[model samples]
Target: MADWLSPAEWDALRLSLRVSFWATLVSLPFGLLVAHALARWRFPGHGLLNGLVHLPLVLPPVVTGYLLLLTFGRRGWVGQWLDQWFGIVFAFRWTGAVLAAAIMAFPLMVRAIRLSVEAVDPRLEQAAGTLGASGPWVWATVTLPLILPGVIAGAVLAFAKAMGEFGATITFVSNIPGQTQTLPSAIYSFLQVPGGEAPAARLVVISVVVAMSALVASEWLARRAMRRVQGR
Candidate 1:
């Protein structure tokens, strides 16, 4: 496979993997927090919060990418401030691709974990609390353990989503080779030229393989987590 694929293809594949990994890892904590709050809390504007969290799912990918560009572009408000204060930039860069992928995948991650949290028995957590465990402790020992499988599922889903992310990533990062060009972007690039079908097909295959592998791994991990939680 190494000999079959050009260095550019390898770079795209590696960049895709890196972007997906970072996107999932960076968003996991936020996803967990949002899922827990949505499942357990009754704060004001709960419906609005839920809708906002899921807005990306319903929004057009191009629109999401545009919104991201406006918010995180070098000359944009938030982007300008971050760049000036923290030297952070997300425009036309690999980091921008990560941000785009994470945003695109966020809704799926939250939804999966939220559904899992909702399915858990609240009394189990309440009992832990009544035993003098603090909120954080109860969540750590009981709530999190019960939701481990869900967390795994959510992360895997997000990773897969990130891997296939194209529209938003291209819009936000402009698909620079060896930098921001990810697998989907690479495939799209290859398809634009004459005689590019073969390379594009190769990338499509890699995408499929990666996605399937992630799903299988998620299932295995979830099952193992459940067994451990069940003390079997």
Candidate 2:
């Protein structure tokens, strides 16, 4: 594998893994919070919040990327503030790629987690509360344990989705080599050049393997977590 790929290709592959890992890791906590809110909360604008959370799934990836660029571009509002105050800039950077991947992957992660949260028995949480457990404690000890399988599934799903993210990332970061060129972007770039099919094909195989492995791992982890919860 090392000999088959050029240094540039290897850089893209490594960067893709880094971007996907960060995207999944950074988004997991927010995904869990949003999933829990949608599953259990009945606050105002619930439907609106849910719709907003899922909008990326329905919207065109290009459009989502454009919106991200508009909001996070150097001259943009949030982008300017971050650059001025925090010395942070997302435009055309690897961090921008992470943001795009996370945004594109968010819906899948949230959906899987929401389903898992919904499947948990509410009575278990209520019983824990009756035993004098605080709300947070009950959630931490009982509700979270019951939904651990789903959470694992959701994280794996998000990670896989991030691995394949292209459109938004390209639009946001412009596919710079060794900087923001993820697997999909690298594959696309290779396709645009002469005699690039072989490299593209190699990356395609890697992408398929990574995606399938993630799915399999998700299933295995979920089952393990379920068994743990059942004390079996």
- Model 1 collision count: 0
Writing each residue's lDDT as its tens digit, candidate 2 over 53-121 gives 999899999999999999999988999999999999999999999999999999999998999899988
List ranges where model 1 is wrong by over 4 Å.
none
In candidate 1, what are the lDDT values of residues 1-232, reduced to their tens digit?
A: 5889999999999999999999999999999999988998999999998999999888888899999999999988999999999999999999999999999999999998998899889899889989999989998999899899899989999999999999899988898999999999999999999999999999899999999999999999988998987889
> What lDDT does candidate 1 reach at residue 100?
95
The TM-scores, one per candidate, come to 0.96, 0.97
Clashes of 2: 0
List per-prediction Cα lDDT, in the order shown: 0.93, 0.93
